[model samples]
Target: MDIRRWALDSDFKVTLTRPRFTDGLLLVLLIAITILSPRLLPVRSEGDTVLVRAGESVFRIPLEENGPHRVTGPLGEAVIMVRDGEAWLENTPCPLKICEAMGPVRRAGDVILCLPNRIYIRVEGREQTDAVSR
Candidate 1:
């Protein structure tokens, strides 16, 4: 009856396992996403189209055409500027002028709103690549 010696001399052993095929596949996917992230993901200033809505009118403007544009709304007139591939709310009749301070927008789905004036400036177009990307 040598129970203490039998317990201390047990033959059980633990071994480490090698990585499985799924683990390798997951690692490859992660690396691919990391490398292609800049191109695949949407950016804030990657579009070249602009849309301005004032009252019942919708005006479509191209970002490449640099100039100041105007729109009329309930409160009066609003000015939008397009320059260097970007568009911004330059002036508005609303009391606070919040829309004018909203700064430039150059990406699809970007919008500047002047609730008091009943006007909005939006960017609506496909994502455009820069000259370098071409």
Candidate 2:
């Protein structure tokens, strides 16, 4: 029989062992899980739907008439409008008004985020082809 002995000082010591192939495989698996996790995870999405997030509140607005509407928030306000086959954030009280800068979202996958007011507006349901066309 053989034995190995190690001496320790007053300071705390940690012993680390090198990872083997199986450990590498496990790491790869974990990486894959992290990479593809969002797809596997549950998300709320429907055909041509709108998502509105304001402060601690979140809601969904369904597109119907394609017209103008106001979305109020804690920090400020925003105006959402649809015209001539395009949807857009027309006005915002935030200083930068970056949301308004993201103009004319006519298809799905478009987003208008107002950082100051903590508001997020997204357009959903247009086809991939249509998105590319614009």
Candidate 3:
């Protein structure tokens, strides 16, 4: 019943707080969500011919064989050549040659992005025949 006695009790000590188990569980759940969200979401495939946009610049690359080609704009223009079942950047106006470093990409999920020129080359999968298309 005495306020002073209650305040001085060992149970009322401020520094004696124990870590709650729920806090650890919540932290683990947050990490799991972060790791799984991207994998769970549907991603656009590169098999279908699509325009890849990096910033304002857009490049249209085909998904078929000899389909993927590089495009150059007014500042500098170059086209990628695909021959003998290989792809390579034939030319570029940029001085750093960073796009050339990307080399050849054959897979359906590859991308070549030039940040300076705002150009993106994406390899997408071909669309399958479905009732909607028909």
Output the number of the TM-score-best candidate: 1
Across 1-134, the per-residue lDDT of candidate 2 in tens digits comes to: 21222325425454657878999999999999999987775443333666767777777666654778777777766777866546667667888877787786655667777788777877776434333332
Tens digits of lDDT, candidate 1, 1-134: 66556656777443447989999999999999999998786555566778778888987888999998888889887788899988887667789988888889987777788889888777876544332321
Task: Write candidate 3's Cα lDDT for 86-122 as tens digits.
Answer: 4556567767878779887554556565666556665
C-alpha TM-score for every candidate = 0.61, 0.51, 0.44
Position 122, candidate 3: lDDT:
55
Model 1 lDDT-worst window of ten: 125-134
RMSD of each: 14.0, 13.3, 15.2
